[model samples]
Target: EHIKNYSKHIDEFRSQANSQGIWLFISTLGCWSVNIPLIQVIAAILLFCIFIFNSKQDMTEKRAFHKIEEDIAKDIDSNLIGDSRKARLYDLGLVEKYRKAIKPVLKTSPIFIVCYIFYSISFLVFFSNLFPRMKLIFNF
Candidate 1:
């Protein structure tokens, strides 16, 4: 039961990370299309910061979930070895169910990384054009 709940929580974080990635891509394109260099620079920086934050959170949650699953498996193994009744309670079917619930969380798609790289390149191009204007405006 607790494992299922934790799985749901992790799933939510994954979903949110994907949603934030999409939003970041859209905002980055919008930033690129806008004529105002200052706004583009500011929005690009902010969106990049958001992307970094979301990525960190997603990684942290996944690591934590993995740790929890490992600990649970260890505990189950120890208990099964120590007691016959507990071993029966922690049967293969129950373990399989837990494994099935967590299987999706373990699988990751690389599309997010591809999208991130694409946006990062776009931002670099956007900034490359804006830097000279910034230099001219600031007399740098």
Candidate 2:
């Protein structure tokens, strides 16, 4: 049951992250189209900061979940006795299997940030060329 709940939470986080990414892309595009270098730079920096904050938050939650799982496993190992211990060991094995299955989902990828950086650079180049007045801003 705990594993199920954790899985559900992970799914929710994934959905929220996807939604935020979509909104970030949309807002970035909107700012770019406005052709104001200052606004675009500000929006990009703000959005990147938000992304970093969310990733850190997600990582903290993941650590908390793992701590809970470890505590449960420890309790099963040290607290039970005899027949109940045997039964709980079976359950522990199942828990281990579930943990292995979800391990990949819990990892935070760096590729997303790399892509964001690439996109930002490409736009900076494009903007500098398109708006000569903004060259000072970009160069700075």
Candidate 3:
């Protein structure tokens, strides 16, 4: 009964963690699309913090779950070892789910990086051109 409850809890936590990761990935890339410098910086920082903290928490939970699996394995009968092993397998399944969920986000990062680089280059070009144009207009 306790094992069943633990399995359910692990599943719920895994799903939540995966969802958070997806959000983080989306927000990180979305930051690049933001034109306002101040807002872009703020949003990027917040999203970075969320990603880091959530990743740390996920690691902690995974370790704890692994420990629980070990303990349960030790306590159960030999015939039940198969069931105990299934719990460990479920942990791996959760990780794979997270990886699959996060894949699109991961793919977007390089695209965002290229876009940001291009944005910076264009901004520099515009500012350079604007300086000369402004001087010509003001006779400076």
Best by TM-score: 1
lDDT of 3 at 55: 55
Q: Please state the error at residue 51 of candidate 1 in Å.
A: 5.4
TM-scores of all predicted structures: 0.48, 0.47, 0.37
Question: What's the candidate order when arranged by decreasing lDDT?
Answer: 1, 2, 3
Where does model 1 exceed 4 Å of error?
Answer: 50-111, 130-140
Candidate 2 lands at a TM-score of: 0.47
Per-residue lDDT for 10-102 in model 1, tens only?
Answer: 556656666666777777788777688888788788888877776676553555556666665665666555575365446534644554564
What pairs collide in candidate 2? Answer: none
Error in Å for residue 47 of model 3: 3.8
TM-score ranking, best first? 1, 2, 3
lDDT per residue (tens digit) for residues 18-123 in model 3: 5665565566567767777767667766766776687557643454666665565555544455766677556645544543465643553444444445444444
Candidate 2 global CA lDDT score: 0.61
Better of 1 and 3 by lDDT: 1
Off by over 4 Å in 3: 34-49, 55-63, 77-140
TM-score of 3: 0.37
Instruction: List where candidate 2 sits over 4 angstroms from the true fold.
Output: 51-140
